[model samples]
Target: MKKTLIAVAVMAASGIAFAASNVTLYGVIEEGVVLEKAKHGDTTVDLRSGFDQGSRWGIKGTEDLGNGYSVGFILEQGFNVDSGDEATSGKAFSREAFMYVNGGFGKLGFGRTGALSFAQSNAILTGWAFGTGYGLSSWTSAIGNNFSRMDNVVSYATPVFDGFSVHAMYSNGLTGDSEKWSDNNHYYGIGVKYQANAIRSSLIFEAADNKGTATADTLVSDVLTENQWNALKQTPAWSTVKDDVVKAGTAKKKALYVINYGFEYNLGSWTPMFAYQFAHQNQGRRTHMFGLSAKADVAGGNVMIGARYLFGKDKATKVGASELSVDGDVRAWNIGAAYVYPLSKRTALKAFAGYADSGKEWKNVEAVGYNGYQVYLGMRHSF
Candidate 1:
């Protein structure tokens, strides 16, 4: 009889423990067909995944500790639904892997997660109207190098006061180096957000310290015009110049910084959003960007339209105390629209089209110039 009673007591304790904890599994799958036209008149049609949003699966759990305190964790992974491959090679949880504690003192988090700037941009900037997918908002904001996530981060969010809150984060090393404490790839960010009845606004500042030499090819290519680059490549002194450029880059580390501001106003069926960003680097590079967007509810669906413009200033690359003129000025614009119709609470059909012009200045940099248009028809399901 004693043994039977002890067993019952143990079972009761188990049940109580289980009641304090909750777990959930969730996922989003998006797939679409896309028609793309390249700058040089090349055209392609293909099936794509995650055009609207990244296809992902995740697990999350929370343990209530009573007294208005709780602990939770999330592990999310992204994948390509069309090819059945992980979004990031060799990584299982690429999107988010973090844990947090919440209470009256606000929330504290650790591990890999979205950066404060990224969160602010999504909450009050472009994401309110057009999702942060393949759109102008994303393109313009990318000039600031506002990465979505950082590794080895410690983050804190203050309790809201009158619809105002503050968030801050620091990453010891973003590259996952073995000696993280000594790694030079450090990131720091802080932001303020205000959300009230009909308006939402945010401002964020971020900085990063990167250590390492800019590649020889990048230095030479960026410092010279297309014709100059082609001519130099054919000269016998090209190798020597390239080596000198590498040495110069190696002598100085790059420091990057950016500031972002966003505002949105909601008026019943219509919402308008505006965002601005300024980015600068120690190498004398600077950029300014502006974005505008709106969303409206019509016919039991929502339609979104957005436009962005970006301009960059020219800077010179210094090699051994001599400045090499780099015509890096860029002017770019993009406009797009999307319509999403809900088939159910967790399912939606979406269609979008956009056009972008990288401008003549950006054509010199193969990585940035993309004069093209794309059209997509897709479906998204969430669970």
Candidate 2:
């Protein structure tokens, strides 16, 4: 009877070992040389990492729990190949660290993960063509200050029905905690995607509520240093409206929102894509962006080219009980192209070049516009 019990325990341990054997490890390494020409006419060249794609290593595993139920976990970390440092300081798995359950009821995930809207934008919008690093879509989307990932996330994704699916997520706080529970940043995102044959489309919405307890003085200091403020005070234009500027800063902070839509169609040899975004922030600042791109197979490789336009509307800030109009409208545009040549199934050589105009500086003291150019050549390998 003792030998029988021991045999049963050995079998149970074997089962556990078999389940653990399902775990998989994966990683990508990319390094490149980059040349950047700043808007101020300064040029710099350096050996950069993650030009085509961010370098990362991850481990993942799944276990079936019978009755069609399964559980999985993933831990991914991003690092710089050039400097051999973590992408995010002090964080081990900065890219992704999440556990999930999957079954007939779709999937539910918890912990740190990518926002639904950001995932949609990255996969279906900007990242489809030349990737997000130097893509024009990335430049235009920055107007919304969108975060790619959030911590303490609770997320759900529905099973695909007729090539359509829905996803949603909420984060208690984007990053660090605040002294007061209500003062932390809360994030919400939702998205819908459809993919059928050669056509793909997605719509996503995201928002963040920044509940910080900041005063007018703090806001002013956040925007300008003492030296800059002293210099600005010497200007006649600034001196006349100094009091109003200070009063305008007294307005309470507001939530930010973004709506993004993307569509793509594949036509055998060539695929075309389009994207649009609307962003609002600070109760006054608003922006709109549009993007168009195309990709084609050439010379045993693929080439992607794209352009984007961004427009910022005039802003208004609250001053005490009244509204104060600020002349902060700006317009910008970007154009870029990328090429990828595959050496093998998991290795590629990539090149990219882009130009961007940042439009006029949005300050009462400055009315200057700037533009710049960038080029990168990189190699990427996956394992």
Candidate 3:
């Protein structure tokens, strides 16, 4: 009788512990074959992984703390299916590793996390770009999706109320410093989102400062007149003086500011997205970008079309007593369709194709004057 009672007591304790904590393991696998072309380069075919979205596995758990409070944690890692290796070097949990506490007020998290702009604009961007194998090749190559993942972040999100919410985040910059208190690298971001029955919108602002060197400006002139060209060639003494001036201005504290807006509207069978962004850097550069895309529901999947434009200008640079202009623009367009045939609830097969044209002028840029085209067949399974 004594042994029986002890066993029952142990089982009861185990059940109670299980009730207080919950854990789950989840992952996705994606692989595909892609054919790509580059400007002035030969076509190449290769097997690829994570073309649509990165392949990753994650563990998440929550512990009930009683009284409308809970503690949760998540650890996710990205990997390559072909080589069976981690995506990032020297780091296991490269995607996300964070812990948070949630209650009626809001959720506060600490650790490494995605930037607010990335999180807010993902859904809207999906409405325009195929996001796989050169779908938004033009926009992404220049404006870069306006997203980045950062470490040493403290993030907070407010609970949704009346279809509105806000998020803010800050990162402590680079790690490993003898005097960490006076570190010069820091990042700050804030965003607001609104979701209604047919419309969704997000606004994000972010800034970063780091003590580093930047290519301040470049001078390009392919259409100079004969006299102008002659003057440039004859100013040997001026070149030496200008070189000294530029060298003295080399080392600088780099700073960047970004303002982004994204919107999506659903019209039953079709969804359209719009995006606008502006960026300014302390290195005398400015950029403006605009994007638009639409998706229409079709037979087992959807068809998408996306386009983007980027304009960049830099302050004139002095070269041999002459102020040279460095300004350029990039424009891209893409249209693709995907058919999804579902094998099961957690698996799907997709095939897609896209085309993009990007051109740059007066920038002396290399490998940039080609039209990109690609096609891919991919599969994704989640568990």
- Candidate order by lDDT, decreasing, is 1, 2, 3
Query: Against the true structure, what is each candidate's TM-score?
Result: 0.80, 0.79, 0.75
lDDT, each prediction: 0.69, 0.68, 0.61
Task: Report the error of model 1 at residue 39, Å.
Answer: 1.0
After best superposition, candidate 2 residue 117: deviation in angstroms?
3.3
How many residue-pair clashes does candidate 1 contain?
0
Highest lDDT against the true fold, candidate? 1
- Tens-digit lDDT string for candidate 3 (1-383): 44334434554776833342666667789898988764545687888877776788876668888899999877788899888988765566877888899988888888876777653112122223443233334334433435456667888888898988887888875331222444324678887878889988888888876433223543112123323433543576645653332223555434668887878899999888887778787555577767777777777666666666666654435322234353544333334455556678889887766655544542332232225567778898987
What is the alpha-carbon lDDT for the whole of candidate 2?
0.68
Instruction: Please state the error at residue 172 of candidate 1 in Å.
Output: 1.1
Off by over 4 Å in 3: 1-20, 119-140, 174-184, 213-249, 314-339, 362-371
lDDT of 1 by residue, 54-157 (tens): 89987666889999999988878889999999887656687788889999999898888777655321223333366457543354233334656667888898
| Higher-TM-score candidate of 1 and 3 | 1
Best by TM-score: 1
Which residue pairs show collisions in model 1? none
1 or 3, greater by lDDT: 1
Model 1 stretches with alpha carbons more than 4 Å out: 1-20, 119-128, 135-144, 180-182, 213-249, 314-326, 364-369
